[model samples]
Target: MTLTEKTAYLKGLMEGLNTDDKVIAAIADILSDMAAEIAEIKDDVDELSEVVDVIDEDLGEVEKDIYEIDDDDDHCCCCDDDDDEDYDDYDDDEDEYEEIFDDEDLYEVTCPTCGDTICLNAAMIEDGSINCPNCNELLEFDLDDIEDEDESESEE
Candidate 1:
């Protein structure tokens, strides 16, 4: 039974016994006070829960607005033009690209979208792409090009 029901049952039992002891009556009074306090606490908890839900909803709206602003701001192609120049420089020095595998034999890749660092083995990279853990963005990598370069270097 609920706490209130249980308290009522206890009160009934105490009264039914017809106890003349002062302690028994005092115990009944204490149980009634406890039951009242419990009810008030429950109400307070419900109000707090409602407030939390409102805050969560507001946070979701804020995130949506931020993403919308980002989308609108993406129309400026100046950032992409800078990235193109960087890529061209990287392509010109292809021979300078060393193996990214660290001591644990895992390739450390930075997600292009979220910039989160991720570690993956050869097979995982060979799958062509993986989702970024931080932003769930699809991060593509070229395993075929790396393998081809390695094969040519070994033959030389």
Candidate 2:
């Protein structure tokens, strides 16, 4: 029925032939056919090996997407703020704004209250305040008025 089955059948028949020239010739023909079939199988195996290698490479990239995180916070915002530590976005306006140390690699933000140091991003700091998600203390303070004064009033 299949190539493998046919090859096996021909091999058995070739071994059991009697002492006749016709039987010998038939055996030779079947051996040649079997050799060609074996070659085709080897080629198919090589192709499958290449396909498996590509699938393995794709799986490695998928692992990175699953493990990567946006924030690398260890203890989180609800922790204590270091009074002596300065924020990443510090200004020289006041003692509260002064940086505790010079660490450029790490981000820093000052808690509006107690002048505590908070290490985080400006975007995460949110609304001019370092509201410590760790201590539940509003670390940063924001005084915002989105309404702008009319230009016509200034001209008058």
Model 2: how far is 77 from its true place, Å?
A: 22
Error of 2 at 31 (Å): 1.2
User: Candidate 2, residues 12-64: lDDT per residue as tens digits?
Assistant: 67667654577666766776687677879888999999999999888867765
Per-residue CA lDDT of candidate 1, range 1-156, in tens? Answer: 877787788888988999788897888788888888999999999999999999999998899788654544554656654635646778756644344443436779998777899988877877888999899999888767878999999999
In order, the Cα lDDT scores of the candidates are 0.80, 0.61
Q: TM-score of model 1 relative to the true fold?
A: 0.42
Question: Which ranges of candidate 1 are over 4 A from the true structure?
Answer: 67-156
Question: Model 2: which ten-residue window has the lowest total lDDT?
Answer: 140-149
Candidate 2 ranges beyond 4 A from true positions: 1-20, 69-156
The TM-scores of all predictions, comma-separated, are: 0.42, 0.31
